[model samples]
Target chain A: MMLKYPNGKPYKPKNQTPEQVGTGKVKDFSFGNRGKTLEEEINETNEYYLSRQIAIVHKKPVPIQIVKVEYPKRSAAVIREAYFRTPSTTDYNGVWNGYYIDFEAKETESKTSFPLKNVHEHQITHMKNVVDQQGIAFTIVRFSKLDRYFFLPFSVLYESWCHMKKGGRKSIPLETFESKSYEIIPGYNPRIDYISIIKKFICNKEC
Target chain B: MMLKYPNGKPYKPKNQTPEQVGTGKVKDFSFGNRGKTLEEEINETNEYYLSRQIAIVHKKPVPIQIVKVEYPKRSAAVIREAYFRTPSTTDYNGVWNGYYIDFEAKETESKTSFPLKNVHEHQITHMKNVVDQQGIAFTIVRFSKLDRYFFLPFSVLYESWCHMKKGGRKSIPLETFESKSYEIIPGYNPRIDYISIIKKFICNKEC
Candidate 1:
């Protein structure tokens, strides 16, 4: 028994029970990653992948504009006055199966659409450059209200971006994402297994 | 006249003068990049390439471990206490012409060897991982005293690293670098056209 969209289609994304996905620490999918954000879960997944030789990925450390630093006698240098720098690209990027993969992870509470305002201009340009270089680029959108995660390829996002640039709607509707994106189920070891979706959709483009 | 190493070999790296390399702003190579370091020159070169749509290389921002933050204003969050985090990979990495490139730029005043101290343990593992994944990996060594730049491929560095792991010499002799690495001449437009060296040495591997 799930709710229906205005277009009459069901809004549920392959409903997987917590028993099917969780192992120990993260047993509840409804809480949206067991008290962690989507980004943290993905970072843990990346670490899991790197340790196991499954894949190599990393969240680019958040850029910070360091204004001043103080080196204490026997302590680490402490950054005193600093501001967060505008990110020039996506959050995560690395080598995956001998191919480059760049992606941004975002979460929204909106039920109908994922707003474009959450992403930056330079980030889109970066994704475009990655695509032009034949790299696999995508975005992971998590709808917190629905406890749903979807992996949207750059191709689809680029189209929507272009449409927005041409004076179109700025947000990608949930229905639009429903048809175009791949659903990501949360699990214990890898909270988000987005690589499976990448391998399925992007392997041909890479090889 | 060229200086001689202890073994009586002439120290030379395809000698090119400032007049040959410079066009406008970076004319005085005798100052060794107009008071700018080798890393700065490489960063400028990366920006030049990025602006021209030639490549997408970026110096990963210095990682910092933030322990505290203060909301100084309603808008800005000022980092109060944070320490610099140890980076797990090299300083630079990107996608170039559909191939992945990872590298570290280093400088030394010592005329004998590029000290292994300049390279870190995790960085070596990272370069190995990049090579294992069929990506092009290398290091840029700027001999400041000699005003020479050499792009040493991971293959060459890996060999030295393995030797060190077996209790061999910790530094790679400049003579060995002369034989194995590509000498990069400083230039104006792209401060360090290391990509040219990449084209010559790594293009084949990528293709």
Candidate 2:
């Protein structure tokens, strides 16, 4: 089904072949991820965390504006017309070891730099508010081509966002990711294993 | 639009007249809430808290499952066939002064007791998980006919839920609410000032 972003931009699904993803012949080799999107991987990780009594996190449902509905006899209500609404906050949030955790997940095929347009203005504001409340806020970025993932704190992202608004580079370079973000390795059971990276951030604050 | 619960139960909106709500002709006297539902009141309160930097909370968007879409050229995509899905978690959650706050809001016309059917098994389980992770979890129940609101903690709700599961009382008695729950007064600016009640919970944990 067709979907649209909050800005009314048509949502485009990334179409990557094994060679394009650099997982080519090793595709048969199981990293427990066989062409799953970042969302699916993160969801699997969350399930693992929940079952293990580690954390409680969830991706908020996509916001939709319902225009019409049909109630049939004794079955269920069917929405006849609706449109996607712009989300005001980040995609994922919950409690982890008493800390309020909030973050967004995005994937890019570009290996050199991640585009700023992938993130939104209101999302930045939401993250800033989360940080102001002393909640842990960050972004999980996947470099699809390089098969790499990085956890970029909201502080680093906000800095780049402000620089772009002031006519600086529109994308964050790979060097920035190397310097400012923590790389996360994928695993079998917990797919993304992002909570470990978050643990480091918590340690920095408390310990 | 018509909506249904996760258990395929048709959602029934509380229809209370001014007299039934016990506000009588004083309804127009303005509590800053004329005929607003509990969800509306809580939403307004959250907005107030956000603007004042007192707390950051939100009501989660309703879950929807899209079946078909029409992507017309030069215009936004339209969802033609969709249905509301059963939500897996509570309706509202967010951070409040670094605390992971999570809760569900419900309203009932019955003044004697709050019906157990208003909450679901999965919701109880979700709240249990949140509490286990050291998050503040509770339910905000509005006794519409009595014009009263109560902050019922997850533990109290869970006990009642367990009793119901074991063929005990199917509802929580009003006396239990009077004895165990904290009362929340509807105000002019925030409408339902629940954060003050939550502050009491935080203090109990710390002190």
Candidate 3:
């Protein structure tokens, strides 16, 4: 229910941002991502990255096990019956400037803290696998009430997720997020400039 | 219409092997893969690789756009209406041994050659992007009638794809497959070990 779209297709809000917001933008999250969810915004950012030949990130298509389909006269095949299969990895992953970039995007309405339940066991395990292979892995968290987004690194997430599994706090405090993660500056074309943070991460690691 | 699975969900057969076939083992194209299509074998090989902590390759879930979904109480979400969408990238991709592995899996019944129409234009373009990013990319071409399979590198595929646009032959002949590609030695456990060919490819590139 979280990522659901009323039009049955979640897509970029064409011509809404630059024209509506005008040279600048709204002061809060409501005006920041008008008429779209955080996922849609990040997808747009990825598309922007793709068009400029900067990065090759993509949200993996939703997993479905098709039971029946009907083909009608040289047209697209219509799926009759299918069931959603649990996805194994994070929603976004791709090759970026010789490094493997992987991450899950999630948004919460809570103003104080982000719950650990926002992530899943399999996803955390997948992130661990990516980290072990020396690939960059992380999460993009959006706090809607606060109008803020953070590029939470996998190392920080794994520590919290691991702590939760061991009967610790059920949520990562907002203060922790503000201090720990890199702030993702929202912009016009690439709504969430998470890769900019990645460049810095790569830079510090190299140094 | 492409990638359709018979029996609704196409999967590997359970426990039929060389022993089941008379004369020690069935020879030629007939026994190259038993009870499963070439795609399934590669998936198994990927599973083997993942299980051994060697790689993390996966067949991207088939692209489906959900139009309607019903949530029955206490059970998995059932999708009532959906349609297939054209995939932009190849079917398979993952990080393997610190390299991004991406490719399409296609099978042809023709014994002489593989047709170019089996691959879409966007897929070829996607392969070019991956190639440009210094990632390992290729196609797993299966000759079903002859029970033969080959690893066709992206360079060869791109060159042929380019030639086709210039009014050249629309298919790659069997002779070209014999010389330009790596013949996969089909095995029992992993079924088709394409990773072995990838190892050689890596060695040659580094050397």
Q: Model 1: share of native contacts present?
A: 0.53
| Ranked candidates (TM-score, high to low) | 2, 3, 1
How do the residues B34-93 of candidate 2 rate in per-residue lDDT, one tens digit apiece? 667788789879999999988889889888766667778875556777666678799999
Regions of model 2 farther than 4 Å from truth:
A1-32, B1-32
* Candidate 3 C-alpha lDDT tens digits along B18-96: 2332122223344545656777688779879878877777788877666667667775556776766667788888886
Model 2 lDDT tens row, A67-160: 5567888756667766666788999999998899999998988999999999989899999999999899999999999999999999999999
Q: How do all models score by TM-score?
A: 0.82, 0.87, 0.84
In candidate 2 chain B, where is summed lDDT lowest over 10 consecutive residues?
Answer: B18-27
lDDT by residue for model 3 over A6-98, one digit each (tens)? 223333323344233222223334565585788879988998988888888888988766665776787555677666656788888888777
**Best-matching candidate per TM-score:** 2
lDDT of 1 at B74: 48
How far out, in Å, is residue A44 in model 3?
A: 0.7
Q: Between which residue pairs do clashes occur in model 2?
A: none
What does TM-score give for chain A of every model?
0.80, 0.86, 0.84
Residue pairs that clash (backbone atoms under 3 angstroms), model 3? B29-B146, B29-B147
Q: Which one is best on lDDT?
A: 2
Residue range with the least summed lDDT across 10 consecutive positions in model 3 chain A: A18-27
